[model samples]
Target: MKKNQVVLFPVLLALFVFTSCNAQKNIPVFSKVVYEGNDDIYNENPLKADEFYNPILQGTYPDPAIARKGNDYYLVASSFAMVPGVPIFHSNDLVNWVQIGHVLDRKTQLKVHDTGISASIYAPDIRYNPYNDTFYMIVTQFAGGFGNMVVKTKDPREGWSDPIKLDFQGIDPAIFFDDDGKAYVVHNDAPNKGEELYQGHRVIKIWEYDLEKDQVVPGTDKIIVNGGVDLSKKPIWIEAPHIYKKDGLYYLMCAEGGTGGWHSEVIFVSDNPMGPYEPAPSNPILTQRHFPGNRENKVDWVGHADLVVGPDDKYYGVFLGIRPNDKDRVNTGRETFILPVDWSGKFPVFENGLVPMEPTLKLPEGVEYKAGEGEFFPNGNFTYSEDFNSEKLDYRWIGLRGPREDFIEITKKGLKINPFEVNIKEVKPTSTLFHRQQHKDFSFTTTLEYKPKSEKELAGITAVQSEKFNYVFGVTRKDKKHFIVLERTEKGSSKILASKEIDFKEKIQLKVEAEGDDYKFSYALNGGDFENLGGTVSGDILSTNVA
Candidate 1:
């Protein structure tokens, strides 16, 4: 147990020291990646017995929202504006995960402290009502005072409960629990269009919950699916809903053409969870947006699905997809795959033929394949080099609205941020610290050495998706000369795009090189040869459908 934690500030000379270590096997947890152009389909290592892997939860970890409380299998995602947003992974074997907490860890449970990077938290579900043992979730607080909320936890690793807003207006929220135990929430309602109609006309409400008094049961609020799943070709943003109940029949699912490149995944049915349902005769059941090689393999935005059932009973599906690296270059953002369903029809489809997202399969029968658990699961051609030497910051390092701690510090000569007199187009917390473009041709390199007391204090390395959409690449000190810049922003507006005047400095090494979402950037001044620093930089405008 190598633990050391420290955090001095003394008027901001800051000296963090958090050094904890354990999963090391020469740094191998997960690494086998291939499928950018499909090298022959690699990805494997779901603990290894007959393999398993296809994101399984890597990088951005978008939308996903699984549950299941007996043999354990939590899962949660979409922590926009990342703070202690939603992120509660634990898996007995839905491809071996591990994160344990974060359902909105305090900050007054984030009732909007100035959110932006695409607004605070949206799309989350995760339920598990064991008739009230508790563990709900239901979210969608996109922006200050937006609606739908709910949090609970008899003990989701050890925290939660405090957000119970939900008067309900819309945005991917879900709850559904029935067998007479009754509990419903299902959302995504606002999209009326009294005008010309045809921009993903949406609607799909339903509410009836009074788990004692926790709200939503006012007028039963029903509207079970309206403009989506073939409204005569006017389907977009049917949104992530989910409702499942199998056999006695209730299904519902969602995610229509809106997360880009026409995302898909329809479905409907129902003996009665609310009203007359019918759609799924294979209605957009699952889609790689019509994957016919998807422009010769760039993958394309796959639906948002959610279903779960395992403990060997099988049937899985978690969604959100991306891995474009080029044309509309998606710098590995929306992630978390894993399909394999086919519950013998009537609903759960997608077991074969989906397009770009099947890198390996098999492993699900009763789990027990413990060969090594891939050391600790972070590999997709492992190159995630951090080097802050521990002391804190590696829950896949994110930041913007939720990480300012006076601008982070991890001393030992690495991972130390600082620049915040307001810079990256200032939406606020701009000391920047990303990390979630996990693949699609990687390489991030850092090594900055900062000493900028002037030129507005710019300390390097950025790729942010907020604070006005980023690109940065740093080093400052103007007039006295010491440049190497290159900026981008675009929404809150900023420009530079390339600079260069360095003859010396405190240190410099910068590098980005993504290669599909096109990044390039490069520096290497005290060590040499990275030096490109010009062109490239698209990343399809960051993403989540152009943040």
Candidate 2:
């Protein structure tokens, strides 16, 4: 397979769930798999039995949380403010994943109104407790206020129950079920002043949870691990906590040093689930902070991990990491990556024996996975075209805050976008639907056919870093004359970067290309050659750190 190849895969878009196999049934089972090679056609052949990709999931599927029930594995990620929040995926072999549905598909399930793009949902933990035959998802709503909530259901693909607001004070809530059937909610507790005074001084707390009462038992709350693995160093942001018991020893894992450059995963062990946990001798069980950025090795910010044991009795860690495009620009945001863990030692470590992360790995023995038969390039790079023929839209397409389905209409021509009263320049949700730029060197082309009634109404393709930072290439009407305009917004200020008058009947095509650390916007008429409309915009401006 060549390095520079773009494969386009066309699949069905739905409001519920789309499965790769057994579509007729509510719980679909895999029959055949698709292999994502560097080609336009799907490799109908099954995997070579020993090879697999690193990022089982691509694009902005970050902060992955996984739970297993028998042979079926269910996965969920932090959807932030995107509608149909917390997408759930089902996998048989843990390699090929298909989007079943979202946990919060209904508007009533979550309140993302006026929430910033990056300030809504944080790290969410999904756990299946067989004791009650229920799947519980505990997460934080970080929009207008800090809210910790939980939602559960027996079936994840169908839908989830309404949010049960909890009294937890902090974020990144996780649930652990002991062998004796006692359930506990462990999470990063906020710092109380007058005690430890450091930048990231925090503690991990646990409380006895009553499923029937749908609340935590009062007076059962206490700090289990204080100030991370070693309190002396005052490790920063000890968040995303999960507890597991193996060999009668309770192992508590949490992310430390924050989520950026110094992000890491550490572990502590205790005889009891509630008290006096000791740090592992080899702390920071997994990290990429020690390594310098290298184009050849693109994975970085590797932390926020969750451990799951497969049917093979082997342990695997699914965590979040970012892949830089060029010059350390992270346009794809955080992505989900999985690595086999070696538990031979007192603690677990990545078994890859490489720095940062490996792009490929050998699958566990006797595991077979089927690709999407027609799915393309599943190894991180994503390319898809949306004709919007169906009544619903693709799950990959995201809107700001809350999505307004009324703005989207299926027309005989194509998907029609009735411009919302607000533009993308505002902090509120808009009529635009966006897909993440999964690859650094890729192009996104969209056709817009609209007759603007007023200058306030303009439809086009936008590359957004946040509500304050974005770039738009749109067409607007002035005195019955159509014009192609390019605008860039920085720090709440909008500027018309460039503009050109175009002879428009009713439609035009807009294209956005990413080359290295810059983006180029171009427009064309009736499927003609694309002409550059504005100067290049630095991709770093839309990076996760800056945005």
Candidate 3:
């Protein structure tokens, strides 16, 4: 019926790591975070004028939900248990996006202080209502006993109000404001009691929303799209319901066939928003399932899209897509992609969405594409180096489950961390900070000025996808000798692949490099040559697939 949705480590020489897990009594600190993207695909097809990259916002930003207000375009994506949930982005041109802030930034707004990595916000929707002159963000908090919630703000940049918990029980909830000033909320819901015809059977439901009360009116909900385009086909996981009205007809769009290779975007039409809807002739307007498994530049699992009128006054869409490596593994997680929609016909069709997607597209007028850090959201090949000198950390550097400020602090020296007593198998937030893996071939190295006096104390670098799926590479003490180790955790099982005795020293450079599925963790002594601790290992376990 519904959906949803982690990060680490010590600093001063500064730069590093996801959900933290340890049975130690020590806390660690880190200084800076340096990430570089060197995908072979980006090298093969460099960015050229009149063309832009597919994912304007990269590195695990998935389940995209978008809305446009005049010249300002606002987009949101699923954050799961990551603190400061609901990462909100802004772009007037759509091609150049910059994250403004999180809608759930305050402690009162995000209650998943100790929830699992897979719980919290899921497939969130952001809409601007001209009638109320307010922006509404509705979502399902799968943790903290908050089933579904909505938050509003006059201006998102200034911050959002506390969430108005909606009395509903579904995920992927969205609100649509009609031209007549009436508002309606739609989301994916489970079949009533035992009516589930097959596995993954679900229904899209809509309810009359009370603007003043900021909740759904009692007993006015209706199931808009049941089991997807054709119930006879028994479509599975029909979710991410969004409603739009154009030319006196209500258009409902949703994602079907789960969030895997079978994923596709479907559309329906009705005379009313709460209706008996009809599937479009071109039911699946967007998908990559038809493409071969061995195709180059593979972008699989494409769906869960949202549409918006671009600055050019043309229809454009932002959707979730996966760019699996040659090994057919997802390490970067689901990313957000954009495409122009051809709505001049009877129904809308995603241009080139059904076909094998190209990595690049000719730029539209008034659209600007730029890579690297700064105002334009980095795409293509770029380098991001962050020094924790400012009071405010980059929005990209976030915490897992708990607030980052609780464990990490920004100071003139570097980012400091006060680790919590997190026992192995304990459900608690880690003393860590995190940045997403942006490319298949990239290097992330941070100088760690640390030494573990005891066996429990450690400080190094790591690649963490969640509490149960991750790799830890750091230094620890054993038998009065300093040693470094590489550990891997997959689906709750963990094992140490390699450990070596080493002379302790400050300013140890810890690095993790990757090429497609192969990952190698290494260390250097006081700017010495990097020593490979673990033989190149497979990174298949580092995936956040909601399959």
Candidate 4:
């Protein structure tokens, strides 16, 4: 059933269809895609003048990391098993951002072609070092049999170098280039051999990094923070370590607790880059665990942050957070968010972060909030469309586990997809091109021209969270006629909700809309009025918890 579905677009367009269909050719063409974001929160509050919404890079973009090079700022997020791993963005002011590209775009760079959706690439850190004038992106890639890899380039726009594998046993690795021209790498490692006191008991280890060799020095490895801030309390899952320098002191910041409700960002300071660091008096600097869950537009799971100096000469932090629907299910995935930091005291604190978060920050004095300019991604309520007219596609549309080039082709007519035999239920990468669920209340409409030659062929739209959790709605053959079927897959078990027997000659319009927990799927034949297919289904299966 993976053959006919080709091309995915964030914006609603005349779905994937061409005037002519070659029976011998296996290509399924999608002309255009257009999507408009219309969440209730945005419509109520609205973007007034200089204000923008929280979760700047919306939809499942988690584990945010930031790096600054003079006036230009760069931000990145963990892509997990998505091909073109590690989505990157650029901005002059933190308010307006445009996606630059991805760090791992080539097939050789991403080896998750056969791995599970949640098994590859965790907690990526992007840093621009002034010493060698290079940008470094380091992370732990679990699939493809690689661990703790780092890649560098003089600039991010041109692309990145092949991985320079770090010889370490850990996850969430970050590199710090000191003012004295020295480099050090810090990461989360398991309690040594027999030292495992408890589950989730982990250690943050540091090693002197060789800039020229692009590897860690074997002899200088040392543990900086073992078992988190207060060993007596016994913190669990302390990871995502970042080192920052202010004046003469060095700060080691990491995400503490598990990535669930108790998740938080903690800080430690020391005189040396690698030393006996002391936890800050004000630990758990940024978190939402203390607030009530029923608050308006509540944001939870606040942790995994990276800091940078803003263009306004103030400190700012970018991290991951989630927006749970009325049912308290995380369907759209973890999103990247930004907040101003107060570093005037001994250590930095996320401003207004302790309170219920309303992340409409005032843009830096002179900068104005502009939406939909060039590649500058628009937040708040706005519309975006793609026609697949270009030779290269936007970075926002990504493939799962495998590179997009392997399955897609750009032609004058439209975008075509060569489906793999693999379905979305399996761990292997499918032919689906995903535009992560951006807004909870939104409409996705596509007019596609596809003919199911057999019951084995199905082509349409799907709302997916992972291989095991998703809603599959597409057109296939049943008996002698073509029928549209809707199936919901949860925890690897699928149930067919409804199937419609329809007669159509050329094209059909399909749509899936959601309002919080309720999701509806419908289709229109030959440009007729859209008719409902599967009444409404719960969107919880399409969302996930951070843990």
Candidate 5:
């Protein structure tokens, strides 16, 4: 399959028969079909583990915390207002990963405009302090509905220390430093406004901080854990805590109900690092127990974990799951997934704890770049159509907020973008033309040539997840010809299933393929034979935080 994959093999066999009829209706039945030189779809090198096997980091929007520093492992997601807000990823073996740089590129440390999509910086947590090698970080701007912030660094790559505010009102803070030195700081509380509190169902605290006086000691704020297990079952909105101690006891791990679906959940403990912490009679640990009549175990929003240990010491957790590929709108975002935690008499378990991250023979030893190997570019298979002349922007492009210098220019014959008018329903934080959701069953083609002056000068190709679920697929303008819609949009609702009648002046190529959540669109005109424009999407577009 060379020569442009044999001219993209009849458009990838009509998108592999509409992804084998949407994978026989929403995956699992031993879902298979991974391709390209398989070896379980390209041995774990930099974790694309054949495109997504229980998320151990896939693409787009990775979220809050995961750190390990001895054999090297670091992770720091949540790029909320996007521009270079947090990112950082490096792995020695926690199942391959790469990207290493980004922790709020100093715009005075984070501005986050309209803050949409669950309000910007929420839950960060990263730590590394070999007696002072330093590298603490603690986010939570939650649109500043209240305080919770901190940043420090010895050098995870220059510049950090700024946003200091921390009187702590709520929204995932976590910081535990004990060994003999003592310095706790768990979080989540800020409900009481007649209680529908941001759906995190409220209550769960633990203070005592003062990294040499950064604050939080006045009355020491400790409520260890509340919202009594099942008060009619509502108050489980505890946020992303994390506290680890083990052996002498002190566990804590958090995240419960309300990250969306399957009722999130992760709860943990043994306790006494400070408080009567208990809750672990095999608590929710994970869910989605095979959905058929279970409906993917009804709303599987599998917690926001983050433990670590491996290199053989065992105990690995990593969390975040969202599975509803297409049917009924779950829009694929929130991915990161790695699990293995047993413990035995103290209890932990989790192997089929809700099924999803399968497909692992063990890979992760390294050295295997496949897909055109090395320094990229046309050498392997990179073709945003003749490269589109890149000037910078290409870690496989990603922007849906934060990215300006006049949003895109690139020349030598392509990429222009420059029309910004905001209000695709009150826009949110800015930046568009996204990318990252790499291969959940690949194929995303692009080719545009607009010459419009009016009719809202639109252009196409989108899949997006935050303008509240997307679809788009080009060509508009009604009465004067040029039609060829697809639309979709959600939450704010806008449907256009399919459309026709075109002749938009000239150049047209537009193509889409997707696979998992089902996608297929085509066009050719002036190169010939492509047509098909009927639409079908399934669900999950990639941004319920981490995908």
Candidate 6:
């Protein structure tokens, strides 16, 4: 017999024997294991899939602000334009978290169509007022000129009150209620107040506010800190100011150096909450420590950090970082990461001063993975594909704004996205392939096969966070020619980075990889090798919306 025939005979014989055995037992058999991951992290301890399939929270976009009430710990993250802004996750131990609910649910709180992902609620700081026994959520809505919006609820899950606008200028408003029962709001100056022009820098200011009255002291705003040091010299866009009083010293922590590569710190201290604050002698509390060659070594875009004390009384800091894709550019969106913080005299001391944490660190203790405990995935991660035949959209997918039910549908073949009234420029209530920010550097490829009858019909892959900034890789019909294009739209301009004529093929497979600050695009014909389209694109295209 031929070599192929000989090999097939044994395989067929083994399959026949296995089928007979299974039939006799009257049982169905599956070769793949259902559970995964090691016991060290999860309770049952299962084999973990490849890293791409299994994403543990890491890097920047974490924007975690945790509040501990008794044994229960509540965590909130910046949702930007994603519907259900401020994802609220609950955890007994800091390591394993389950999504409990979202803070903003009412239609009055968020408009999914007009507000893009980056325009929704910016950085939100969650805190519990012990005296009144109430949960307060303070978020900066950038769509309304970086104004602070306040929402309070006795029960975070259901009884949230209407959003009350706090008259404050600045993005990333943090609320702090002092021991004396007085509440203060600390934030940066508004962008249009000429701060972005004079020094190209905004001042970090503190103002007393009455949550009950829903009003600030009007002109009571006082500048607590300003850009001055080497990292802050060139009109640094200081934002996300968090204040904590510990050991008779008031510590002011804020992010500086813009929100991109080479971004560093600007921490200051003041004995009193209002008076002039002094910058730390060793500022820039943290940076991309993994890169050691230059003082400004670039890796992850780390900022928007929150500090919380564990039940064990140890302090931990959670912030966002971007992990670049294979090309060393980050496009997967920012991710959250945790680091240890120690007090040196009066200032916070980070190991190696301002370096990024090593990939491997001691996992937090007292964490037990509770499978099937969350509102979405009670059993941990599940398999998901762009294929639309599934009954409902996976929880992993999030619309920049709330989407209408008619926007998308599934058939046995694949997902069918109905054209909406909006386009890429205008915030569309329904858009194809909308998802939350996952990792910084990851490859997202999809097979889109659509025959547009007219020039209005378009389909493709997009890395979109907001209406103003996004990158689209797809085929557009112009005149009678079908053009494969990679276009990036930012501010108000849509520029085609690369384009080519499309060949009528079975399907179009579009792949985008973001390294550090660069993006690579390629298209393949059926299962053939990917052909590069053109010149390299800067990673900055994504930086605008993400930060």
Candidate No. with top lDDT: 4
TM-score of each: 0.34, 0.89, 0.94, 0.94, 0.33, 0.71
The global C-alpha lDDT for each of the candidates, from Candidate 1 onward, is 0.65, 0.71, 0.80, 0.81, 0.57, 0.59
How would you encode candidate 4's per-residue C-alpha lDDT over 1-547 as one tens digit per residue?
0111111112111121111233335456665576766888887886667666787887777888988998888888888788889998999988889898999988778899887677688889999999889999999998887788999889899999988888989889999999999999999988789988877898999999998898999889999999999988989888899999998999999999877788899999999998789999988899999988899889998999999998889999999888887788777677889999999999999998899998466666888777577778877777777788987888878787778787788888777777666677788767777776788777777666677776767777877766777788888776889998889888899899999899998677788888887888898888799999979887766666411
Q: For model 2, state the Cα shift of residue 298 in Å.
A: 2.7
Sorting all predicted structures by lDDT, with the top scorer first, yields: 4, 3, 2, 1, 6, 5
Badly placed stretches (over 4 Å) of model 4 are 1-26, 545-547
Off by over 4 Å in 5: 1-77, 84-137, 140-183, 186-208, 215-251, 255-279, 290-298, 305-321, 326-331, 335-402, 408-432, 435-503, 506-516, 522-547
How far residue 10's Cα lies from its native spot in candidate 3, in Å, is 22
lDDT of 3 by residue, 1-547 (tens): 2332111111101132222345333434565557787998889998787898887777778889888888999999988877889899998888878899998998888888777666788889999999978999999997777789999999989999887888988778999999999999999989888788987899999999999999999999888888999999989998899998888999999999988779999999999888989999877999989877999899988899999998777899999888877678777877899999999976888999989998898899756566554666788888887777887888887777778888776666577666555522345776667787878888887767666667766567667766676788888888899988888877777899999998845667788888887888988887789999879988777654411
lDDT of 6 by residue, 1-547 (tens): 0011100000000000011111222211111111111112222334333111112353223466778788777878766666556778776656666766678766677654555445566678888888788888888775634357888888776747778888766667788878888888888764444455444366788999776796788888887766535433464667778888899878888877665665555578888888578888887777763464332223466766777787777777777666554344444556666676776467775554365444434444654444344443332233223454459654444554554243455656555555543456566554544544343333556666554444554556666544566676666667788777777877758888888987765466666654445567777766678776766676565553332
Score candidate 3 by lDDT. Answer: 0.80
Model 6 scores a TM of 0.71
- In candidate 5, where is summed lDDT lowest over 10 consecutive residues? 1-10
The digit string of per-residue lDDT tens for model 1 on 1-547 reads 0011010000000111111222111111111111221122243322345765576765677878899888888888877666667778787878777777678867666644565555668778988888878988888886657467888888788889778787867677798889889998878776554633654477788888899888888989878887787778777567777888878989888887777677778888889988667787767767876656446445557778788887778788888777654465555577778777888866677776365555566776656533224434453455444466666665655555655454566665555554444555555554555555566565666565555544644555666666666677676666777787777767767788789888754666666666555667777776777778887767655653464
* TM-score head-to-head 1 vs 2, winner: 2
> Per-residue error at 450 for model 2, in Å?
1.4
Give the least accurate 10-residue stretch of model 1, judged by summed lDDT. 5-14
For model 2, give the 10-residue run with minimal summed lDDT.
Answer: 1-10
Error of 2 at 383 (Å): 2.9
The residue-by-residue lDDT of candidate 2 on 19-38, one tens digit each, is 12221212111111111112
